[model samples]
Target: MKKKFSLLMLMAFAAAYPQDVKAPDMSSPKWLRNAAISPDGSQIAFSYQGDIFTVPANGGSALRLTIHEAYDSDPVWSRDSKMLAFSSTRYGNKDVFVISAGGGVAKRLTYHSAADVPTDFSPSGDKVIFSSSRLDDAASSVFPTPILSELYEVKLAGGMEKRIFSASAEMAVYNADGSMIFFHDRKGYEDPWRKHHTSSVTRDLWLFNTKDKNYYPVTESIYEERNPVFAGGNN
Candidate 1:
């Protein structure tokens, strides 16, 4: 009983006067890209040096996740924050790749030749939505002469890909209920290098329904409205 009491007192004293420990060395010359917050709001996932990494949200040494020769960018977190979906060119093509949030070997999700850039995960966390420029052969559609893009979703376990929106959609995020998706759209969108030019190529915000497959305009104006996000946890 006396030893137990002493241990308890030591624990109490430590809690009362905790020591500040230094974080891990995070110094790196490589550029950091595509940083994402975990679902629980504890950690952040990012891509650096052609690989994926996770670091403490506050400050600490980052944990490296993926190590590959191919370039990996645009890390998107699952709703549960246990997994991350990113785009990699390791398989000779830019396709979606999923990896554990902690760190591990990444699994390829998409195998198409077209570049599939992961944009967001479904609210249910079962499907991952991405943007692709490769045209779907089944859909007899017509896009701009050179550049064309659309939104698509694939299962986490890997299966048939589904087309969500048939437009030049970028960064499409789903609501909490997964009934609606909000994204920035600019079919044949102009390049950002054209800083001063204001043409019809300006991107607009649009909302699409997953159930009815109906889409409508949220905001349309001369000014470019891109990167639409939900606030208050998409409530």
Candidate 2:
């Protein structure tokens, strides 16, 4: 009789919770991610579900920075710590955008058809660097989309974008005085589970001279060494 009662309870529990369903809290305030600290170290910016938020660096209630139906993430702060640059799909494609660090309406910066992910702020903090495949030479024969990427910069005050670097250079950042740049020469550097796998396609660190547009390898290992930035960061 005890065995029979236990079996009945098990069936009831199975019926209450289905295996294929996701929990309601999967996309809530508890799911904040992609956090970045401000240049002055006073605040932290993060993404929750599909919105962007800012909270005190010392820990406090998070303040929502973006409230929209589209997803916004990958936030980077400007040097003066007065503005934040992030990526958003609000315009149908992921593009560069900026908002007040204190919280306000976000302004779209990039309008390319391809994905434009914000990498970092310019050394002067007057512009933002983003990685994308907006070049004319990008491979399009692939069934879905091209994988090659390049870097570009757009003014924070809003203006035309300027091509910074050519294909295969991404997740790039500038030094304090904008005299040099640290970046990776790989397209799939963003893949989450690519660790311990070394090959000819592995991402390597490269330091670029902004003045003469010359570059040299910082790391030549087959292992991944992408997304190079300063200790405290250029911005």
Candidate 3:
């Protein structure tokens, strides 16, 4: 019987490849990073599973901010705690994007080909400070490297970005009045997250004065120092 033989073949194929597949467990998420608290200290934003999320600082249900398939990370809150600026790979490169604190459509800020990562928002919250390896000075002779990025700022209303500093300064956070910036300086190629290993390649803390364009060393310890943020009252 030809019909009987066809049914047997179909049964064998179904048994070989099952239709149901188990989904990944999300009960306990691990490897969440780039957590930052809002200026008002009401909620905390962070990156997990290639998306941004916010949870109450006092411990509560987490709110999903981004639901896109693209990779998004580094949620930096605005000074007023109404907006968030983050880096996403939706447009081929890591470009800066801003979204409301309550979650909504995101607005693209930077359109450069190089990766742009948001470091902090301006004191007035009209512009966002980011770091990118876009270009260097025409007179400089140093070789180009992606690890060495330059600081830049883009308007929140959307426009061309302006270069702030031409050097490798990562994870930079602004002071209260935007007069000074506390950031960690990179000397050479080294794993930023590699801890407890002390060597010459370790990163150091520095304070950059916006008025004088000068750099002041904050720490000279052999241990690695990264992600320096200004506390209350210029401390």
lDDT of 2 by residue, 1-235 (tens): 9999999999999999867976667433476677888878999988888888888999887888888999999998888888888999988989899999888888988888889998889877788998887664445332223476777889987888888867567778778888888888764535635668777778888888889978888898868777677885443
Each model's lDDT comes to: 0.83, 0.81, 0.90
**Which parts of model 3 are misplaced by more than 4 Å?**
1-25, 139-142
- Model 2 residue 137 CA deviation (Å) reads 6.5
TM-score computed on alpha carbons, candidate 2: 0.81
lDDT ranking, high to low: 3, 1, 2
RMSD (Å) of each candidate, 1 decimal: 15.4, 5.6, 6.1
Tens digits of per-residue lDDT for model 3 on 1-235? 9999999999999999989888877877889899999999999999998999999999989999999899999999999999999999999989999999999999999999999999999998899999899897676565678888888999999988998877678999889888898888777777777868799978888888999988899999889888887777467
| CA displacement after TM-score superposition, residue 115 of candidate 3 (Å) | 0.7
Q: What is the clash tally of candidate 2? A: 0
Best by TM-score: 3
